[model samples]
Target: MATTSDNQLRNPPLSDQARDRLRAAILEGELKPGDKINIERVAETFGISRTPIREALKALETEGLVQIQANRGAIVEPQVWQEIHHRYRMRSLLEGYAAELSCGKRDKKLIAALQDNWAQVKKAGQAKTVSQNSARSIAELNRSFHRMIWVGSGSMTLVRFLEALDLPQSFNDAFYKEQNARQVVCEHHGAIVDAFIEGDTAKASTLMERHVLDSVDLLASQADDHVSNLCC
Candidate 1:
């Protein structure tokens, strides 16, 4: 149904940058979950036209970060607590399996790559707080870490399935911005990496499951703190 001109207009590399930027806005809470994104405003902000913005938003939609409408603009996907639980539940299963498979590969080069990305994740956690600007870099490192595991597993099928399970960082960004919470996350990353390095498949799987669930627990705790503050 589409014309060749329409296909030619799409720029994937540029659109990918836009997608990452928009996703960061959602993750940093600059664009709250369930909020509508203005295409024109985003175009102005990024100096790109609506076509690329649409492309990027559409891409993010596939990743569960935003939802697009025909009549309206894109909406940052709403994340209910139950939805969060479900997402993490799926992540625990798929990522745990990915980690388990990756550990079995026993590839030293791949292990080093994973370690390098994990170190970046650890370093990024040092910021006293996460902001719209800072979240992009951290997200990049986090993405790399997860992608390495998927690739290391050497299962294209597993990698494809795991692609959709990216954490809605918007939910946990504030929690991770806190010093104590950030430290705990860093420790978890370290332990997981250690498992991979030692080729401990079982430990990797268990740690991955715990790490995914821990995020949900942290978000719930943050929500409770907000409620208590209101009550007080």
Candidate 2:
């Protein structure tokens, strides 16, 4: 898995790495809706060239994370409640199916690994390491947990399609930021583990669906409150 480095994230070019960071920031609400991203300023801040920044912005344009105006450069787009709902629907359908297939088939080794990741999430959250490393560790654990379940389903095509679905517009990342959200998500992981252990495919699928949808609702509600404060 070739990935952009954290150094790249901190000192980015207008490349995919920069695009990912900017997108993460927007989704995380560090850069809010209607905020303008000055390409020159961002370039200077990240110590990168404008070329990669422009390129990254273009990539984000396709993902609906940022909108580029003829004269306005890049601006964060306002995400409506409905669209967020729709995104979760897609996630639920895809990941739920994966969970269903995963039941009774998940490699024990993989489950243990996921368990380890959850422990890390707990440790990082307790340590109050809210910096990028802590955040990334948490996010990566979450991703690994889901991906392992999905991959265990043995549906390569489904896994590929779900991968294409990619990260939602910063929604889950936002949920991870909330103090209570961490505990909720970890407990949700526990629920998922229980279902898997029982070899109850239906239960696993239902839990996955509810877990994901609950997250959507939680994040959307928080986003509403945050946006309200910004408006004030």
Candidate 3:
């Protein structure tokens, strides 16, 4: 448990900021898998104390971005390619079911909103030349597309729990940071949008599953390469 002075808690919104900063660091590969994070160094860099750092780290732990040990403080957990593949399987099964349900339940307005969101993603990718940073924009759009289906499924608890999985920080980070990941994800995004527009639940479900599986395959194949390049 983390105890905080009233003054410290009230003084700065350190927890939220630190959480964001730490998440960015992890996703950006600045903090590689299995890297230990020094609490004192983080506190000093951020100009706060360990109280907020601990709080922020707790949030990261919940998202599977970091680990806390009784003996060791904060460390980035090692990512098992196999485990990541399993998670994609879970997302595809659940999200595909949600998408199928959404096809029957979604209103025209919801469909239109999804189209508009994809348009923005397409434009952003083109305008930015589709670098690693640009890939994040498309990943966010991809989340929005699937999230709409989750919302339309009318299962609040399931949707909330899925949201808690933090797929963006986990799965999205793996795809978006790779140099070629941008182009590959962009191609998949187009395919997914087309499937949605056609309102073919079968097509949508199959495409979604393949999209996720293919992404995991691509990332896993390059995992060792990423580790070597990024863990310096």
TM-score of each: 0.62, 0.76, 0.69
lDDT of 1 by residue, 1-232 (tens): 9555654556436787788777656544466566788888788878888898889988888867787888877787877355557877988888899899989988899888878877887887787777755666665666677788888888898888777666545544455556666677678878998998888999999998898788767655555443111000
- lDDT per model vs. reference: 0.73, 0.74, 0.69
Better of 1 and 2 by TM-score: 2
**What ranges in model 1 sit over 4 Å off?**
1-79, 168-176, 223-232
Residue-wise C-alpha lDDT for candidate 2, range 13-57, written one tens digit per residue? 549777876765665556677778877777776678989888988
Q: Where's the lowest-lDDT run of ten residues in candidate 2? A: 223-232
Candidate 3 has an lDDT of 0.69
Best by TM-score: 2
Per-residue lDDT of model 3, residues 1-232, tens digit only: 9888898756647897788777756654567778888888888878889899899999888877788988877788777334456667887777777767666564677778777876776566554345655667667876787788789778887597667644534447446655466566667666766766777778777776777778667765564443322122
How accurate locally is residue 113 in candidate 1, as Cα lDDT from 0 to 100? 85
* Reference-based lDDT, residue 3, model 1: 54
How close to the true structure is residue 61 of candidate 2, measured as C-alpha lDDT?
A: 78
